[model samples]
Target chain A: MKYKAKVFVTLRPSVLDPAGTAVQSALTQMSYNVESVRIGKYVEMVLDATDESEASDRLHQACDQLLANPVIENYRFELVEAL
Target chain B: MKYKAKVFVTLRPSVLDPAGTAVQSALTQMSYNVESVRIGKYVEMVLDATDESEASDRLHQACDQLLANPVIENYRFELVEAL
Candidate 1:
């Protein structure tokens, strides 16, 4: 079976995001009245697996081992059967 | 009122994503059985607005004007009242 995974990788709240800070400052200068901005990465993938459970497990392992840095990031994923 | 917005910026399907390709190749070499990978940006923001409609409008404007590249990327956002 083929499954599609949508993964979100975000910085832990305690971790500072300098890029986000710079963008926020720029927006504020542009008079956007922005309160806060946090930036992260969104990854989508299609993978072959035996079942939904197996696909989910593989996706989680990918996030933990390859996609996300556990020390400064947190990750989450959603999986669905793909065409 | 404070509103939270989750924005997703992705490359149009017709556009090629080199970074995704590199990652996919690496994953395949690692024996992950990955079919395809797409990479994008996710942005979260908290903003002050008069109502849900206003918040939604502001978020859309942000995506259109600054956050996303309309030439090759598409964007979508979700807005919710913030506690």
Candidate 2:
């Protein structure tokens, strides 16, 4: 079976996010009334697995090992069976 | 009311994504059996608006003008009431 995962990797809340801050200020200056903005990486990947549980395990491993930097960033993912 | 929005901006399917290709290859090399990988930007924003409709409108405008490049990228967002 093939599984598709959508992974969202974001900076830890305590960490400084200059890019997010810049976007927030830009939106405010544009009169958008935006209070805050936090930007992160969204990754979509397709992988092979024997079953849903195995797929989930692989996705988590991939995120932890390669996709996210655990020290400064937090990560989460949703997995679904691919057609 | 304050509204929170999670926006995802991705490259069009027809567009070539070298970074994605690199990631896919790297994952496969790591014995992940990954077929494809695509990366994009995920942004979370908090904004003030009178109502849901108004908040939605503002978010759409923000995405169009700043959050995404419509020519080569596609964007979608989910809006929810902020506490």
Docking level of model 2? high
Model 1, position B49, has a per-residue lDDT of 91
Clashes per model (N, Cα, C within 3 A): 0, 0
Total clashing pairs in model 1: 0
lDDT of 2 by residue, B40-74 (tens): 99999999999999999999999999999999999
List candidate 1 segments past 4 Å from native: none
lDDT of 2 by residue, A8-70 (tens): 999999999999999999998899999889999999988999999999888888888999999
Specify the highest-lDDT model's number.
Answer: 2
lDDT of 1 by residue, B1-83 (tens): 99988998999999999999998998888779899999999899999999998888877877888899999999988888899
Candidate 2 fraction of reference contacts recovered:
0.89
| Each candidate: RMSD | 0.9, 0.7
Q: What is the TM-score of chain A alone in each candidate?
A: 0.96, 0.96
Give the number of the best model, judged by TM-score: 2
